[model samples]
Target: MNLPKPSLRVVFLLAVLVPLIGAFLWLALTSGPLAPVPVTLTTVEMRPVTPTLFGVGTVEARYTYRIGPTYAGRVRRVEVQVGDRVEAGQLLGEMDPVDLDDRVAAADAALRRAESGVVAAHAQVGDAQARRDFAGAQVARYEQLLLSRTASEDTAEAKRQEAQVAEAGLALAVANLESAEQDLVRVRAEREALVQQRANLRLIAPVDALVVSRDAEPGSTVVAGQSVVEVIDPSHLWIDVRFDQLGAGALRADLGARIALRSLPLDTLPGEVLRIEPRSDAVTEEFRAKIAFSTLPEPLPEPLPRLGELAEVTVALEPLEPAPALPNAALHRRDGQLGVWVLDDGGPRFAAVETGARDLEGWVQIRDGLASGDRVILHSRVPLRPGRRVEIVERIPGLPR
Candidate 1:
């Protein structure tokens, strides 16, 4: 059986009507009011929010040791060069013991002379003692002779006088020996002082450290307190961070920090707040904070981060109460109040939010006007406004379901 032919009017109507319907559908899906605006969306939810402060900082040694000479002298030799790793008591440099050596030698000679004088004084005392004994025997014999009327009285008196003279000589010798001993003591002390002064000419490292700089080279003249070599303990390194005073209220000792060394941008060093400086920078209106590494880098990377290296630091403050928080990009300023564009059945609505603490990861706490499971626009390809129709093109990963 042959099918009935369609009329020209039906054909025209079909062609025209179908095209219009197609066009309308295409417009609706692509560019019409019904079309969904491409946007990045996220759901706000309750999460532990840790307030953070971001600041530029510098890596510094907590204690810098400036090794210098104790007195003015010409540097004789330097054992270590700049950037050399040295241990405690390692010889660093030495000053010319120009006159110090001579002084020590003179003190030594003086000590020997004092010792000889003591020996001579002792010998004199011995000689006087023997003489006194002989004189005493003579006096005794003369007295016996006189008792027997065999010795003259004048001879006995002369012998007694001689004994007394010997006794006095012995006392004088003892006094001379004591004086010599004191002179020896004084000379020995002088020698010790000279030796100490000579030892001071040798510069030694006070602790295990990295030699950062060599201020005075060999043969260079340096005055007292003038740095010859600057050393710093590598293990005792810390970062000196300066945060804006306004945002540093919660900063204190022991707070955790994330540090990005300028040289190693990809690696984040874990750190803890060591101290908050009592004084703040008046010019910058910032507070200085000292942060130390939580764990030292193992096998410390070569060309170790030097002192005064620039770094970026983010300090984690106290955790705030759990609240529905959204990405910071989701929030916008509307009439001086912070609000986020919320996706509702009606469309994108301007939801005024009272925000609380914000975290380093860009999450802002929505203290009011938002709840868990509420979708907020993270980013938009087109400008957004209140009551505008929009559909999320993609939901950013890691957002609440």
Candidate 2:
């Protein structure tokens, strides 16, 4: 195809105009009032919001039973080992008898001897009582004979003395019987104490629990109150958490909560506030609280969490309420005012806002000066001013609209 060649003047004019046009376009985009300021925006919305408190905690059993002996002795044998499930009153281990059996036998023998003594005292009392009766009869016969002059005065007097002696003997025998009975009682008490001490040598489970630790082994010497095995009730597990005292006001018994165990990060267990401790940790400047699981995992993970396993707990202090809310990142401080830069018809404008409680998930409640469906500037490439022209590029991810 044939084409006409352009003139030199025309070519020069075209080249000059092209570059000038390009420069003009660049200037208009960079500095013109109509230029668009790239920014990230989030739409404010009203939904349910709940203020929450986060804390690092540990899983603990409310009732931990330490199995040990009441007296110092050598551990004879441990029947239950760590990780073993035990029932209340179940024997876990035993301490060496070490002459305890012998002591018990001796106590039994003493008890029998005391009983025999009582029996002998009773027989003596009976014999003395018979003698007193016979002596009294003889005294009566002598008095009658003396009255009739058939017995001498000296004989009657001797008979009366015999009766008095017999009465004294009977009283002495009765006193001996009481002493023997008291001795029997003392022996019985000693025997009972020995039996109890013997039973103490055996370690017993105080409640249904899983043995978490073994502090003493068979043949190892342990003192009184020294723990041999440690067990905890799985049903009584709870999370012990600490929060800043300033934010602990909302925490109370029966408040709902969520817990994430370090071992099971994928799972969030339902929980409720159990108690707020009266005392706080002075060094940490934290308030102590306990949270219990509302429902354990359907199929609890094998080898349940250890007694002091690390966990994270978030307590829901208040019920969900509808309110104007925005992403926490959208908030900015200018002129000592706590607020956010919102997009109006003009551009990014700073709006002073009163904020209420915020959640752990980075959503802040807008108490005033903002309404639902308002677009707030999340981030801008350059500093923004009131009425500044802006272009919304995208919505920030994970923000509530």
Candidate 3:
């Protein structure tokens, strides 16, 4: 009725194989390819989100002036250098007055000569008038003599003819005087124009400004309209920003902004949306905007923000009412569907979701297919699928704590 005792070889094989098989199963279930994926989780919450638009920008000036001569000339001297502060009408530099001084002197001389000619014409006119008066008196006297039978008719007729000639001479003299006066006026105008040209040669600042550039130096020849100095109104500085078109729907003027200059990354300056540019960048799919400092830093930052320097800008948009939302990291794309991996009593499942606006803090609005109190996978160590096994973690590796 008793069974036969097993051999030693059989016993040895049974002990070795049993432990080997158990070790294999433990490895497969724990750290092998069949193991559960580790992920962080979060619950959907109902709360208000203050959305913000972030954009990269550059420092710019609202008013820029290029100081140069109206006519082509060589630079004679430059009184101001780059970074100099200038006031309205401040002389910045001067252009070579090649022949302008000489031209002005010549015009003055012409004007004086015209005046002299006018004076001479007036003297001639006076002499003609005296001659005319003498002729008239002689004609009147001769007519009286003729009436008294003391003068002949021929003599009376000659005196009358002489009076007519004198009258013509007086008229000619008056016309010459008028011509001289007109010449004098023309010369004066020429002189005034020359003086203006001479004044223009001295480059003057058109406004109280800070000189940002010196384009031409002394002895440098430049063409008309070429810049010798470039300046900008320091108080009217702004940033030219570009934001993603997708998040710019709520962008508007007067919205509050925070600007971080590349040079001063640790400090953020207060600013506001000056304006939204009508033109958008089609190629980059971005909206252009102007952001101005609400109040400049007191005493200004050492080494002021240079024009064209890069900056990071954040514009505060209208706050959203309380709504069901979850961390944007929870959203995922699978099988051409936007969704989140929802964890439930059954298991992890893929739930397609409709999303709305997102905020700067990484929260996204859940318009549909999700509700408050629902738990979802925020970040997973690997790609997720329906019915995938997962392990909830407090924090995922390689992510911010």
lDDT of 1 by residue, 1-401 (tens): 99989999999999999999999999987888667676787889889899999889889987799988788989999898988999999999999999788888889899999999999999998998998899899988999999999888998999999999999988998899899999999999989988988888888999988999999888899999999999998888889889999868989899899989999999898999999999999999999989898888666667877788899999988998888888888889888887988777758878898988888788888888988988878887667877677766655345432
Q: Give Cα-based local distance difference scores for all models.
A: 0.87, 0.87, 0.91
Model 3 misses residue 52 by how many Å?
3.2
Using TM-score, give the best candidate's number: 2
Evaluate model 2: give its TM-score. Answer: 0.83
TM-score of 3: 0.74
Clash tally for model 1: 0
Query: What TM-score against the true fold does each predicted structure earn?
Result: 0.80, 0.83, 0.74
How well is each residue in 1-401 modelled by candidate 2, as lDDT tens digits? 87889999999999999999988888887766557777887889897677888899999998988888888899999998788988899999999999999999999999999999999999999999999999999999999999999999999999999999999999999999999999999999999999999988888898878999999888898888999999998777898998887767877899888889998888898999988999999998999999898987655556887778999998877756888888888888999998888767757778899988888778888999899998878877667888777877764345434
Worst 10-residue lDDT window for candidate 3 reads 296-305
Per-residue lDDT of 196 in model 3: 96
Candidate 1 residue pairs in clash (backbone atoms < 3 Å): none
lDDT of 2 at 34: 50
